[model samples]
Target: MSRTRRTLIWGALAIVAVVPIAAAAYSPFLAWRSPVYIVAGFAGIIGMVLLLVQPLLAGGYLPGLSAYHSHYIHRWVGAALVTAIIGHVAGLWVTSPPDMVDALLFVSPTPFSAWGVIAMWALFAAAFLALLRRRLHLRFRTWRLGHTTLTSVTVLGSVVHAMLIEGTMENMTKTALCVLVLSASIKTLADLRVWVIRTRRFD
Candidate 1:
């Protein structure tokens, strides 16, 4: 394919990936909601959108970026993802402390709460693992395995959590984002199989 064509295709894909999120952020229903809830809701939406980007970065799907640059962006995006999650949870807590506490304790009546909590912790665990990787002297394969496992949980749990919430996000758009997130994650994980195969050479 010509470079121009590839660029256009990737650009189109990027727009398709983000349009749902943009629509959710502008949700007309937000007019009736308080600022805190609006912040919280948008934070969650941004985090969900980030989830879709995360795997795409890892898979190096963005046009014109080298794998090294893509991975660098991936790391930064991971940090942003953590920040977004904190903003989301903290905003929700501000809106309702008791509910947030219940969610944290896994006793929230809302099913989405449990999944969000799970994904949150999984994200933290993944970050911690990355931090400790060099200090712990973990093998490359071992680190990859653990990181991938935690990421899988984070992605799946976050998708479920977001889908369950019937808040500001439009249903069809939210579902489409979830599908894209899952597809990107699965594709990246499948690519990781190459790493697994290489590990056998060392073993």
Candidate 2:
């Protein structure tokens, strides 16, 4: 990890993480869409990008940040992730009440709706449990199990949800982002080795 190499790696990651959202911003779909819908769509795109960062931060794979700072940023990133999701859903609800209702009720005819709803709930659940883990007196193993399980559900559902839709985002960039996100998440989870973990307080 020489300084130059680390800089290159971080720069590449930044480009990859930012490209899809950048491409989406120029989408012709915006011309026909309401302003609220456009913002909602970008919120979803930003949320997907944050998913790529979350695991990289958790696993300390990014350059320049030590464990403590990385974990500290991870917490705030998680909060931003939640806010992005809320904005996405809230804007969508405002743009189309019936569609939002159908999606929320899990009875939407569109397949992606169900996946997005499931992922949204799983994400909220993971955040909620993390926030209350201390209050709940959860053991390390218990917390790890619940967190990872919810994470897998969230990743799986979100990738499927994003992939199933043909929206403002350019398809190739979206696919690349999705693949990176899934790969990063799977690698980080495998590295955790939760069953053998030592209950260290790195977080």
lDDT accuracy of residue 191 in candidate 2? 90
TM-score of each: 0.91, 0.97
Cα error, residue 44 of model 2, in Å, equals 0.2
Clashing pairs in 2: none
Model 2: ten consecutive residues of lowest lDDT:
194-203
Per-residue CA lDDT of candidate 1, range 54-105, in tens? 8888777777888788888888988988998999989889989999999999
Q: Rate the local accuracy (lDDT) of all candidates.
A: 0.85, 0.92
For candidate 1, the per-residue lDDT at 107 reads 99
The all-Cα superposition gives candidate 1 an RMSD in Å to the true structure of 2.8
Estimate, for each residue in 1-203, the C-alpha lDDT of model 2 and write its tens digit.
89999999899998997889889999988999999999999999999999999999989999899989999999899999999999999999999999999999989999999999999999999999888988999987888789888978988999999999988999999999999999999899889776665657744
Name the runs in model 1 displaced over 4 angstroms. Answer: 194-203
Query: How does model 2 score by TM-score?
Result: 0.97
Q: How well does candidate 1 match the true structure in TM-score terms? A: 0.91
Please give the RMSD to the true structure for each candidate, in Å: 2.8, 1.0
Clashes of each: 0, 0
